[model samples]
Target: MIFTGSLNAQGFEGWFNKYLLPSLTRASVLIMDNAPIHRKSAISQLVEHTEHQIVFLPKYSPDLNDIEHDFSALKRKRMYASSDTSLDDIIRDYCIT
Candidate 1:
């Protein structure tokens, strides 16, 4: 989902319930960075109620999180995009491939 503003706990919770939770076909370990939204009790409660688990990465360890690399690459690729290029197209071409 492309969100225009910062993601708050409520937004994350909604996305978790609507998308992430349903996508888990089996019990899985979800590794997350130490973002404040990820620490919300409601999100934790939801995850705990399911077979999936959430593991927070150690503080200040971006290298340990794979998505950071993807974000970096996305930013780099976005720099080269023409003014008319859409974010969805950039992501599809540079990230999703």
Candidate 2:
């Protein structure tokens, strides 16, 4: 689930608990960027008690992440779209294929 509120550590913790934890089926590695929220003490403790592992990307190396390319492609597709376009419509159009 996409969280639409604060992007702080607390928000991340809630999202991790409500969404991520329940989706896992077995021990796995989760790769994430070096964001402060991802490295919070609460998140560390949570992960330590779970059957999952969290690995952070090297700092200053966003180019190694593929999500950036996905977002860039999405932005490029909507470059000429009207500013009034609804987000739902945009998501449907971009993701429906």
Worst 10 residues of 2 by lDDT: 1-10
Q: Could you tell me which 10 consecutive residues in candidate 1 have the lowest summed lDDT?
A: 34-43
Which candidate number has the best lDDT? 1
Query: How close is every model to the real structure, measured as TM-score?
Result: 0.54, 0.52
lDDT of 2 at 92: 80
lDDT score for residue 9 of model 1? 76
Candidate 1 deviation (Cα RMSD)? 10.0
In candidate 2 the C-alpha lDDT for residue 38 amounts to 81
TM-score of 1: 0.54
Per-candidate count of clashing residue pairs (backbone under 3 Å): 0, 0
Best by TM-score: 1
Model 1 lDDT at residue 16: 87
